[model samples]
Target: MNAISIKGLSVSYDRKTVLTNVYMDMEAGKLYGVLGPNGAGKSTLFKAILGLISSNTGQVLINGEPVEEQRKKMVYIPQKGEIDWQFPATVMDVVLMGRYPFKGIFQRLSQEDKNIALQALEDMGIANLRSRQIGELSGGQQQRVFIARALCQQADIFLLDEPFVGVDITTEKKIIEILKQLTDKGKTILVIHHDLSKVKDYFDKVILLNQWLVAYGDTEVTFTEENINRAYRGQLSILHRTTLD
Candidate 1:
């Protein structure tokens, strides 16, 4: 079965349609890049799959089951802007939150959980900064902390929104490498990305959206000039100068 299946999904806010009759199936062990212009419903699609928002029509199935049934199997790393940097949390405190889904209502974290969280921090190369305040970290370090949390969760599917924004080149490269490694382990990942130039290198497949499903398939085959033009629409001139050439 596909990792995720969306059938006739639509969403609206205040009577303004954000997505319309979108359908797609994502497979496991692959990295999918969700591409779209601003206000193209990329984030909405993530919210729908994560069951954070009610869809106007259709359903989202995870591994052939309703999303609610598989909520613990997925992890969502939202955009940095959506987070509160001054929440007074430490690196370890944030990464340990991933284990909350596994604990019972009154259960306390065990040593094993701490070990797992520390391993994730080590994997992200931030183990030494485990006690640092979250707000004290740089953008790249902050992104790594969240990804470490996802790793600690041991979830099968990951949804990351614009992870590369505001990060250094080295950190960007490292993060992609880690994501690719996860795919190699049969984990499904979807990223909402805006850099058309890196799509070819960063993702195995592409889901082009513009308030609707435009094109989705292997990057080399589906990410063609024509499909890009169709998705970006009036933003072609800007993309041409920055990415498409």
Candidate 2:
């Protein structure tokens, strides 16, 4: 079954139509890339899929169930700057927060939870950053920390928003590797990537959107010049191409 399915999805902010009728079916166990220029409603689409916002005219289904009730299986990573790392928290504390769903609101972390969080950091190659204050890291390091937090969630699906925006090359490579490993194990990944150059190597599927659904399908067969022209008005689409070597 597909990991996510959206039909006739639309969203408006203060009466301005930010997203128009959009339809998409995202499969499980593959890395899908969301490509578009700024103001393309990429984040809004993410929010809708997570039920963080209500869709105006459609339903969002996860594994054939409503997203709201099935959120337990999905992990979402917002853009890095959205969080104020200066809020006085250690890396461990932040990553461990992903374990909250498995615990009562006021419950303390279990030994198992701690182990999961640590394992996530280690798998992400940032175990050394566990003891540092969150705000003390570079942009790339900060991005990895959030990805680690998502990993700690232990969900079957991951949705990362602009994770590589300001990260360093080395950290980006690590993040991509981690994503590849997870999907290899049958995990679903939907990532919002701003760099249009690396989409080819990073994602198996592509959803080119611009406040509306322009294209959605396999990367090689779907990212044609005609479809991109409709989405970006014919300007060379940012095809963030990369390959794992």
Candidate 3:
């Protein structure tokens, strides 16, 4: 199924165009990486897709429906740098926030909800840090906690921006493992990544972007030296080894 369809997409602020007439189809049950350099409008593209900002032109459809209704099945894990690190909340408390969709304005959490949240924490390997305050966690721990929060949502699609950034090697591996598991379960994933060395191994496909669509397909075909150099806006290339599977 086509999870998302974007056509003639364009976004600008104060007459400065960030993305030019872009069109793409994101398929279901696939892991797609959005590759771009700084100021490449990758994050802006995601925000537009999520309807965080209105686009002056183009139409974005999710699962053959308007974006608003289909957004319920979507989950977003923002960049760690974007989060308020000083928020006075515990690891468990953060994970519980993912369950907010299941609650009515006046409703309280049930025992089943609590158990599911705990299970999600465990799945992300943060069960031990349940009681720890969010600010006290290390860089890697913080990423895992955020991922745990997303897992608790159990959404069909996961959109993560710079998920592996500012984390330890161990934490990076754990996050990749969790992503692989999601792929195994047929969950569609879109991740904005900067690291070229690990891109081919971590992602099933790459969508090279630099304020425009460069290439969209398998890494073996699209992540070529010439393509990467052209899309990355410099002397850089995607290193290919093998898929995560």
Q: Over the full model, what C-alpha lDDT does candidate 2 score relative to the true structure?
A: 0.83
Q: Which prediction has more favorable lDDT, 1 or 3?
A: 1
Best TM-score among the predictions, by candidate number: 1
For each candidate, what TM-score against the reference? 0.95, 0.90, 0.90
Cα deviation at 32, candidate 1, in Å, is 0.9
Worst 10 residues of 2 by lDDT: 236-245
Off by over 4 Å in 1: 238-242
Q: What does the lDDT read for residue 72 in candidate 2?
A: 78
Highest lDDT model number: 1
Residue pairs clashing, model 3: none
Q: Which digits, one per residue and each the tens of the lDDT, describe model 3 over residues 1-245?
A: 58888898988988998888889998887888898888888888888888887755898888878778876678888988888888889998899988898899999998888898999988877899999999899988888787777788877788899988888778788778888888788788899998777877888888888888888888778888777777866645333322221
**lDDT per model vs. reference:** 0.93, 0.83, 0.83
Model 1 per-residue lDDT tens digits across residues 15-131:
999999998999999999999899999999999999999647888999899988998889999888889999989999999999999999999999999999999999889999999
* Span of 10 residues, lowest total lDDT, candidate 1: 236-245
